[model samples]
Target: MSGSEDLLELAVETAREAGRMLVDKRPVDGPDVVQTKSSPTDVVTQMDRAAERLIVERIRAARPDDAFLGEEGGTSAGVSGVRWVIDPIDGTVNYLYDLPDWAVSIAAEVDGVAVAGVVEMPRRGETCTALRGGGALLRSATGARDLQVNAAVPLGQALVATGFGYAAERRARQAEVLTGVLPRVRDIRRGGSCCVDMCSLAAGRVDAYYERGVQAWDVAAGSLIVEEAGGLVGGLHGAPAGPEITIAAGPGTFEALHDLLAPLDPARD
Candidate 1:
């Protein structure tokens, strides 16, 4: 963690570069290219590829021996212990719709642990960065400031944010789960970007967040930011977070929120 600041800088730089590429290529109505992945709802566009290529190109140029994993592209092995995990465009649908919630996320992991993370929302002109031990910070045209979640907020009054997977079955299950969760909390917001949701929690914009079937690149950086911002993160049923499910919140609401969602755990679905 102490040695992670440099890596954090690198991640921030990479995210900024990738974010600019996405903004420059912002689709006018719709992007030039669009492709389906596992389903019709899950789509990718030329901007995703272009941004990922730009990000990978920058990281590969700087750290040739470092491994890389990206949402648009697959994995690239390297000798360096540092592995750069990336999401060129975190909210593809948002980007496609020209929504302001999309972002570029990048994280640096050493020995399978995230040491530094960065998320950039180009349209919002917002950047969130964090190192393993260092604190989380959010930057905008206004200025930069340290990030801290509103841990004192009670679970009942907390504003929760979440996202559903693209699969129809998964969406259906998540909807049912939300039906139960909505009445228990203040309200729920369906933000399109995972990084944005996590960073928003870090900035005290949201009280809690959880999602199932999140890709590694989706939460990698954002989780670190949450942790550094005095928040807790865990997977479904106290398991380590992965592609299954992830829940993040301040210490006060973590357990209570987790307990409430345990019955609806997507891992069980």
Candidate 2:
């Protein structure tokens, strides 16, 4: 297999491994297994640590020289040829609550540009994959199939997905923007996971998704999936998404959403 093919295979395998661990560990009766990370609301659990270890170990074994950046474990040095970004569990809060919206996200960056990605929703048995030049895929037990964004809805009449930031100040800003946007759009949802939110947008389940105070690992995989699926993924200003934040929308709705969010001035208002 080619280099991209190899990365794709590893991403899918590692994600599935993590997903299995998450699905198998739910409690029948007891308090959830949770602990504070950065804060009380910023939660982590045994499954998160185990999943990150599994993903890191697999990638290290397969490509010993490739760099790694994960949500739980922070960053590690590696050769410059390739870097793997992993989010072992994207929606830990939901997962702890026994919600079905969590996912394992993985992406490969070549020379700092994402070339391939995989987002696996364990409970739903859905795996969304994408390559830089190749199109996107929605995989399930039924079969593997191509995916694309739907552009039928206008910007004002479309549903949008978003999430709150971990910090109080950032969350306040997000609320401010929501105040401006809610009345103008069809609807808005806070789905608890930026990775899954972006994938849902890519799959045309929602018209757009934008959020501030997100890490690169949260959206790296999903952003590429959106772009490869014929959607636009970028910053709130409609520029290329970076390590800072993400703003993604379908072709039909991106421009208007960008305009609506510009006043927030994520950098300086």
Candidate 3:
């Protein structure tokens, strides 16, 4: 297998293992299995911990010298060759509420660029994977199929997806951008999961997606999937993606949407 192929296989395995753990142990009722991270509103749960442990363990076993950065557990440094970025459960709140939109996201970054990625939605039985120069895939028990974003959406008629940030100040800014764009778009959806939102854009379920104050793990895997699927991934200001924020959309609508969001200015506003 090629290098990308090997990374893709590892990503698929890690994501599926994490997804299985989440599906089997997700909290359905009672008080949520919750713990605070950066703040009270930024929560983690038993499912998140279990899934992260599984993914970290698997990646460590496969490549013991590589570093890891995970949502629930924080970071571990290692050799500089490869870094695995993992968000074991991308929608902890949704999962805790018995919602089916959460995912297990994993990405292998080589020299700071994600080369292989996987996002596994256990409840949906869908595993989306992408290799840097290859393409994206939507795999399930049903079958595996190549994936791509829609190329025909017009700026005025596009459907968009987004999420709210945990911080009140950031949420206020995001709301302002939403208010500006909501009236011009065909529709807007707040699905509570960044990974799923990007995947939806990749699969043509939505035409655009944007968010602020997201961690690397939340968007790393999904961003690559969107790009490999023939979409454009960037920051809200139309800059290249970094470790903390993301904005992505179909080819036809990305520029227009970027222009509309430029006034919000995530860096200075």
Judged by lDDT, which candidate is best?
1
Candidate 3 — worst ten consecutive residues by lDDT sum? 25-34
**How many clashing residue pairs are found in candidate 2?**
0
Q: Which residue pairs in model 1 clash with each other?
A: none
CA lDDT of 53 in candidate 3? 83
lDDT pick, better of 1 and 2: 1
RMSD of 3: 1.8
Which regions of candidate 3 are displaced past 4 Å? 28-32, 236-238, 243-245, 266-269
For every model in order, what is the number of clashing pairs?
0, 0, 0
Q: Provide the overall lDDT of each model, using Cα atoms, as 2-decimal numbers.
A: 0.88, 0.83, 0.84
lDDT of 2 by residue, 1-269 (tens): 67887899999998998889778765555225557765568888878888899899988988888999998874798875798999988998888888889899999999888999999999889999998899999999999888788664676788989888666776677687789889888999888988888888888899988777678899889989999989988775546675455778877588777887787565331
Residue lDDT tens for model 1, 98-211: 889999999999999998999999899999998888899999999999999888577789999999888888888888889989989999989899999999999999999999
Least lDDT summed over 10 consecutive residues: which range in candidate 1?
25-34
Screening candidate 3 with a backbone cut-off below 3 angstroms (N, C-alpha, C), the clashing residue pairs are none
Clashing pairs in model 2?
none
lDDT of 3 by residue, 83-159 (tens): 99999889888887778899999999998889999999998889899999899999889899888898757767898
Better of 1 and 2 by TM-score: 1
